[model samples]
Target chain A: MGLLAYGDTGWGDELFFATLMTIAVALVAIFIGFFLAAIFASFKLSSIRILNLFGSFYTTVFRGVPELLVIYLFFFGSSGAVMYVAKIFGYDGYIEVNAFFTGALSIGIISGAYSTEVFRGAVQSINKGQFEASKVLGLKKKVYYYKIIIPQMLRLALPNISNVWQITLKDTSLISVTGLVEIMRQSYIAAGSTRDPLFFYSFAAVLYLFLTFLSMKLFNNLEKHYSRGY
Target chain B: MELMIESFPRLLNATILTIELTLLSLFFGIFVGAFFAVLRTSKIKIFQVISYYYSYIFRGTPLLVQIFIIYFGLGQVEWLRESFLWVVFKEPYSCAIIAFTLNTGAYTSEIFRSAFETIQKGLIEAADGLGLNKLHIFFKIKLPLAIKQSLPAYGNEMILMLKGTSLASTVTLLDLTGVAKHIISTTFKPVEVFIVAGSIYLLMTFIIHNFIKILEKKLDYSK
Candidate 1:
């Protein structure tokens, strides 16, 4: 218990901030995933063969590969690729890629693959009659999508989006291997220093469980709110 | 390209280890999953709550954290280290298996619980009317029906576990990804090593996807 005390004596402050860092990274990753999901979902839903093939390939590769490998790829590749581009521009200095950026991007890509499926499913679940009705009323395609299609898609995708968020949040733990001071890494350091591996790791587990429980409640409320008329 | 070609044999051998880890954990996971699933759906409140929390806690945390908890954290336990159980936890391979089994068991229990819950009331009532005892009803009717209902989701879980086992490398177990990481560290070719490793994973998942599809069709009693 004394080891958990705040301030200089304990790791309480570090762990607290690390938990926040985990949430921040997860939020950024999920934000990136939303845009990627939109693009990939549209590509998948489009009738164009090449775009459909590209979309499916992206999803399959990301979904199939281990997330740790994906993180490692980004961690190792991003710096070299950036340095190469820098050299092409006549600057040969090493440009370090930020761990936060790589972490979020890798997790974002993986979550994007999942959320693409969710978004695609949501759009497909939209009743054909909705499209027919908008056309029957002579609405513009833009207006139809803005008013009818997107709203329904968001509503239908909310549950699965929550699922993707949970995964994204957990995936942040893998990013700790890249030296990010998130909950996992923070706990790892604390445990090693204190020689109380069980205490710190259990503490980390509790923090994760707490985040998950809170988000579950939040998502449940969001679902209820969105389902008001339905 | 040449580096990938050169490392292919070692990677292939490691892929065998990866497959071994996935199958062994999943084999044990199924039993643990089934037990918890039954407890979750049982009439007793205590059993139901116990299974609920077991799955809840395990499923809520990341598998890496779970691995660390078992492999590193548990080693700090003085009594457990002195106990005979430490022999199992002493090795990274077994620790990874234990972590993966519990993690997959939590997920599988949820899948099974839903499957069990969806068993039609009439079917169960018919079994009851036929004078089948509780154990008989479970083994004869509930288990088979739940397996059928849960197969698709269980297939997805299998694929997930396949990917998840790659984490064993973090604990120093030389699974497929572990071998790739080793090669990368020595050759300094992360791109080539990962590409080869990633392709192997994709090939494995493709096989699993098709295999599950075939299994689903075979198990479709309606056909």
Candidate 2:
């Protein structure tokens, strides 16, 4: 098969599928990360000292360590942990967390640490007077967040969070070590199977470039919308 | 505890590899990054656009992806396989250094570019009024000031690079995290190994933070 030929004769098919998995993992991780970050950010913002300390510990430990270490940590025991939880639910059969969930969870958690910082910074940037103003107007917390804080926070946090999202996308490739069939893993597999590491790997790199290009466009548009002149 | 005692030498050995990769790549990356920063802000639109696009692709993408594409991507082609560059590309260590250097370069260049713009116009005018040429002003005044201004950002970047060095494990380089993973595979203690590795990284990060802080103080004293 020719180097660039499709129809499973070359690296083309594998590279394309890998690209899809990469995007899928990135989306999954980012969503989970955003949710977890919001929780931690709120926790950090709360009045309780212990809760704030816990938040501090969470960010310190995760953010301080390397992403690869986190991945290896989770990958080694994630399946066992999942199975243990499953056993409590009256399911005895083996319930393993395959590479996808393992990768997603690790990246999601790592990205969450970063997202927490971004979110905390954004929320903090808003003047306390605004909240005070909202309270004077008899606005509920939920209503205030929805109508005022969330919108403004999005504007403040969009660039930083978008950058974290990009970090998440790239970190997904690290899970190839866990034997995940994501883009990088797929490329690695094709490289080994075809003994043509250079071509397949280069093709996968292009897929990443494509995704990065797409997301940059999204962030720029979002920035424009939140921009003062616009 | 006993296991750690036995593993200390091995772990220490791996630490050397980790440090070598981190320091070498960072030094080289900063050089490349500074170059790109100049290119990015140069008057020529093509230079500006090219540097911008380079940063766009690199900074926008994850380091792991870039590493993978380079490591596996280069191996996929027959032509590259035939090329002399295969000697270096075939090795995991060389490929990792290349990847880390390129990725850090993209980010640090952005730091430089921002710091460059932040140099006060008045500062430039004052230097000009002193009869200093562009080259003299840049080297004697601008560069030093930019370094001081950008140190905190570079501090963060250094810690990131420190952590990012762990990614070299994926390429089979057996750095700290790689050794951790290896130890866990044998000892069946994932959490312990990770905790140990994590602490080491934290120590490294703290060292970098202190180093940058010291540099700032020194720069302050000089002024």
Candidate 3:
């Protein structure tokens, strides 16, 4: 119990802070992923064959590879890429791509792949008549998208989005490998330093379950709100 | 590129280990999952609750945490170290198999449970009326139908397990990801090494995905 005491003597404070960081990274990655998914979904839905091919290829590659490898590639490769660009501009000292960026970018790319699938299904499910009616009304593409398509797309996609959110949240643990001080990493540090592996890990597991439970409830509520009219 | 060529042999061996780990754990997971699925779908309330909590806890948390708990948490227990269970639990390799098996078992059981539920009651009643033994009915009718119904989802599970095997690298197993990390550290060529590693995984998954699709098509009697 003393091991879980607050402040420097224990890991209570660090674990709490790390839990917050986990949530932060997951939120940022999810937003980045959701944004990219919109583009990918649109590509899949586009009239051009090449765009559809590109979209499928992106999802296939990301979905096939392990998330850990993706994190490693981003963590290790980002610096070299950054340095090459820096040299081209004649500006170089040391540009470390922080673990946060690496973690978020890699998982964001992964989450984007899955979200693309979900979004494509959601977009395809929307009534074609809605689009035709909007076109007949002489509504601009932007207006129709915002007024009709976006709202309905989101309502339909909420269930899947919530599923992806859980996946993203759980995936934040992989970020621990990149040396980010997230919940998993913090617990590892405390466990290693204190030589109390069981307690710390069990604590970390509980923390994760707690986080998952809370997010599930939150998503369920959002799902209810979106499903109100239907 | 030259360094990657030199490392190909080593990477191939690592890939073999990853495949072995995935398949071995998958074998155990399937059996365990099937048993739990029976429990979950059984008439006994206690069995259902036990199966429910097993799947719930395993599925709710991340696999990484589960791996850590098994590897680190179990190691801390002195009684476990002294027990015969240590033969399996003491080694990182065995610990990993146990973790992956249990984790996949939970997910697979849910898949199996749903697949079982989808089997029409009429089919079972017809089998019962034919005077077939329960064992024969389960083997000829229930199992085949459930498996055919569950193949697509099980294919997804296979891919997940393939990806999940990479986590074994965290426990110091020389699986593909672990070997990739090692080569990256020694060669200072993370980009090329990881790209190769990632491509190998992509190829394997692609093969399995297509293979599963072929099997699904072959089993599609309705079509």
Candidate 4:
């Protein structure tokens, strides 16, 4: 009863804010994922065999490893990376990389691998004749890409994109390790401090479920919008 | 450096435990995943729906959160502590194994479900036309094909699960990552220790990926 209450003794406010943080991290990850995957997808679809192999290898290596290890690597090695970059620019003071950035990057790279797969499938599904016709119509490749290929890819890629979105949302919970004051970390502290595991965890689970439920609804509507004619 | 050399045996022991945990959990996870795949693909709507939602919840969340819920969350309860089940829950190693397996099972089931559904209907029809019964058709034709189709996805899942075993360190299971953490805390050098740890993981992942490549080639699945 004390655990569930809305007072200071309870975790009502902390849980709410933490859930918000989860959503924030998730959104960041998804946006980054979309951008990275789109580039990789295009590279893979390119006619050059070397480019295709590079894209394939990138996805294969990233997807084959665990997300946890990626996070750990970035988490531990980021300082050195930042210092190296700083030295290149002649700003050699101890500049620290934010843990949030590290966590988001790790999750983004991981999710991007899957999104690359989705986007590649979508890109391949676009009729080859359409691209040829655009070229024959004297539309420049850049204009043709923006005006045609990207839009159709979005439509074809919507459902899978939504699935990736949901995964990214849940994966934000892993930010607990990065010392981010996200929902999982907040609930972890409150639970350990209060010794009310069931109450706090149940709260955390509900928060995750709520975020995912909203995501499913959002994606469902997006999918519906894309699927209107069909 | 001497301390690190001294801790080599302990780290080696922990490495063995970590490997055992990952492989064992993977074994159980694959079993559970197979069952769920069967259920999801079955003609029964209820089973399909139930498995779908279950996998949804598990796959939607991080394994770290899941392990936290199982190890710390469940262990904090008074009743659970006193209950017969506490025997399993009391050990961080056991709890980590259970959590990792359950989480991996959900993801693997999705891979399998996709693989299963993609099995060509024409092939099944051909098998039937050849006088193959359901069991014979499934055992001789469909199952092998589905497994072959799933090998790439399954290989990725295996590596993901292997990487996930590193998170067990948080719950006090001193696997490779755990050893790195302990070393870093002692030497105050996260970079060096994590480099060693990350290299270890990277090496293992590359090895597994090659093995999967070989197996995929052996399967010779053009489709």
lDDT of 2 by residue, A1-230 (tens): 48666766766676677788888988999888989899999889999999899888889888889998899889887876777788888888876677888899999999999999999999999999999999999999999989888888888899998889888988898888888888778877777777776666666667788888888899999987886553
Residues A34-116, candidate 4: write the lDDT tens digits: 88898998889999999899899778766655565567667767887888888999987987789888888888988898899
Task: Estimate TM-scores for all models.
Answer: 0.97, 0.91, 0.97, 0.83
lDDT of the structure predicted as candidate 3: 0.92
Model 2: residues with Cα > 4 Å off, grouped in runs: A1-7, A10-13, A83-95, A228-230, B1-9, B68-87, B221-223
Model 3 per-residue lDDT tens digits across residues A67-88: 9888888888888889889999
Tell me the spans in candidate 3 whose CA falls farther than 4 Å from its real position: none
Cα lDDT, model 3, residue A188: 91
lDDT of 1: 0.93
lDDT of 2 by residue, B1-223 (tens): 7666666667677888888999999999999899999999899999999899888777766687677777766666678889999998889899999999999999999999999999999989999999999999999989998998999999999889989988888788899888988998898667767767777788888888899999989989456
lDDT of 1 by residue, A167-196 (tens): 999999999989999999999999989899
lDDT of 2 at B125: 99
Question: Sorted by lDDT, highest first, which candidate order results?
Answer: 1, 3, 2, 4
Candidate 2, residue B175: Cα displacement in angstroms equals 1.0
CAPRI docking class of candidate 3: medium
Candidate 4 chain B least-lDDT 10 residues: B188-197
Model 1: how far is B40 from its true place, Å?
0.7
lDDT of 4 by residue, B1-223 (tens): 5655555565666678668887999999999999999999999999999999879888766677788889888877789888899999988989999999998999989988998889889999998999989999989888898889899888878887887898888898888878776766676555555545555666777887899999888888564
| TM-score of model 2 (first chain only) | 0.91
Give model 3's TM-score versus the native structure: 0.97
* Cα error of candidate 4 at position B148, Å: 3.0
